[model samples]
Target: MTKSVGALTVRTDPTLKEVVVDGKDMSVYVFAKDTKPGVSSCDGECATQWPPVPAADAEAAKGLNQELLGSITRADGTAQLTLAGKPLYYFAKDTMPGDVKGQGVNDTWYASAPDGWKAGVKRQALGVLDHPKLGKILQDKNGRTLYLFTKDEPWR
Candidate 1:
């Protein structure tokens, strides 16, 4: 179950916790072109497609971190909820609770993480690459190579 803190909430994904708005499966997004931190660049037509996440009531936060939660005043003077200074938004096509249609739209928009981080797609390796010093290196299904640093500790 997702833990609700006022109008905002947190949902667990495989790698990290995601922010959900309005207690629904709606995943919030951040625009890459939003040059101004703590302010939303999406407005007018853009705002119609990506609706801003409304701020939670002043006294209502359940499991969300208070420090990372905040609000920003939009051009229309409406207050919208912000996480880690990034304004949150919802996708239009996500009609269901668990829809992630907005995960990586336009390479500019992405699902918002609880820590105000952006999630990346996980790729599977199909073959290996011949490295000069590293020898044979693992490559993803798309030919992207990956590396394991010697300084990294083993997973427990």
Candidate 2:
């Protein structure tokens, strides 16, 4: 259970950079399977491992848009906090405030960005290269290849 009502804030994670976290600094997450707003698919054993963040008394911290803060009723009839309509959660393994043990888990879980997007996964705005044998490939600004996995879905 949540100890007390807290504000949602952004923090710079070592790997994720800017990610949303509870006031206590515990990292929050968004499940890719949760495709609809005001809804959550994580329950039972899933809820046990990734607990839903309670919606009660949640507010956006400084620099975060309050308008994006919202809540959704879970299947269990409890209010879960949301960011831009995506449900927020806390990984059970994340004992410390900054722990992000759930990031990229099964390629379905990701730390939520401030705008309710996936954090840590940076998409290069430009830089595509053509290889003599490989044809065209995406690359980062620094010319590093951006390998996209076939199973990865776009996070909108």
lDDT of each: 0.66, 0.81
- Candidate 2 clashes between residue pairs 3 or more apart in a chain or in different chains: none
| Ten contiguous residues with the weakest lDDT in model 1 | 1-10
Q: Each model's TM-score?
A: 0.65, 0.76
**Candidate whose TM-score is highest:** 2
RMSD of each: 10.9, 11.4
Best-performing candidate as measured by lDDT? 2
- The sequence of per-residue lDDT tens digits that candidate 2 reaches over residues 1-156 is 555548888898887788888889998999999976467989899999999999898999865678778788888788898876788888999999889999999999999877666789875576654343355667664345688688877893
Task: State model 1's lDDT.
Answer: 0.66
Tens-digit lDDT track for model 1 on 1-156? 212325556566655345444565567777788868557899999988998877756222454555666789998887887766777788899888767788778888877755454645433446554332344657665445566789988994
Model 2 CA lDDT for position 104: 97
Worst 10 residues of 2 by lDDT: 126-135
Candidate 2 at 99: error in angstroms?
0.6
Taking all chains together, the TM-score of candidate 1 against the true structure is: 0.65
